[model samples]
Target: MAILIPFGLKMQAQNNTSGNKILVVYFSHTKNTKEIATQIQQLTGADLFELVPSRDYTTDYQALIEQAKKEINADYKPPLKNNLQGIDQYDVIFVGSPNWWNTFAPPVATFLTSHDFSGKTIVPFITHEGSRMGRSEADMKKLCPKATFLKGLPIRGSSVKEAKPLVERWLREIGVMK
Candidate 1:
């Protein structure tokens, strides 16, 4: 179930004719992160890009958690199967990731580091079990030092399917939506 997204949300697409290009880049192992990414793409009329690591991750939840922890602890950046180019054209970049060990996943780190966001505005959106953003935002700031960051939106992983209203409210509060 990708998106049985609320009807109101479908009606909320801004189509962003303000002449600023936007992009939504995300990595989702459970599809929870992708759910929110899709909503933001629909609402903001942004380009959508998925970060697929070179190798598929383990399906075992316990193993996945252990692997993610090790990667995070080691500050390892996994190679992605796909990379986005022409990044300079976008003024706002929405970075979506599932929080791993209190931070964004390693693939997301690779994506951020691979681009030059010196003048771009980075908007982070995370799906977490309970940590809620955790150190994700601060970590992103360190990785993309020249980029301006908006207050991040954190939705519980289990609640992503029902996150429409919260997503809308945050977009409006951030002046991305009217």
Candidate 2:
């Protein structure tokens, strides 16, 4: 079951076990992270929560780069359009983001800080152009100190559609999927 939240954010229900309540939360600018999040959801039967920014980023490549650099340098966390509810019910969270300036996007940082994930297991995944994983895992670990961090999967942005096998393998390796 998928619930359509305000601002076009969709949350999908997990139809698996009740013990391991899973949530896949992500911030996707170019849809690469979104694609990976969808694959993870399929494999684990997890819920989906998309982080939509209140302010939309520019579509121009150079402009987007400049904006990202400015935000990262300032350590800015843009406001999210919709806030997620019932986050405490999840035990495992899969966080995905595009690699921006060797780190996760600013909006992902916002989402992390907004929620309290004291005892949840966090599995990170990144879609990068060339800088694989970048500093995303480290950054996330810093933000979510109390959560258990798993080995992250980094896929090239251009090859996201072909990433099902890799994503499945990582899920199995992490013991999220059998």
Per-residue lDDT value at 58 in model 1: 95
lDDT of 2 by residue, 1-178 (tens): 1232332122223333334878888889988999999888877778788889898999999999999999999999999888888999889998999999999999999999998989999999999989999989999999999999989999999999999999988887887776
Off by over 4 Å in 2: 1-18
**TM-scores, in order shown?**
0.91, 0.90
Please list the C-alpha lDDT of all candidates, in the order they appear: 0.86, 0.86
Q: What is the RMSD of candidate 2?
A: 3.8
lDDT of 1 by residue, 43-145 (tens): 8777778899998889999999999999999889998877676788788889999999999999999998898889899999999999999999999999999
What TM-score would candidate 2 get against the native? 0.90
**What lDDT score goes with residue 139 in model 1?**
98
Clashing pairs in 2: none
Q: Lowest lDDT 10-mer window, candidate 1?
A: 1-10
Worst 10 residues of 2 by lDDT: 1-10
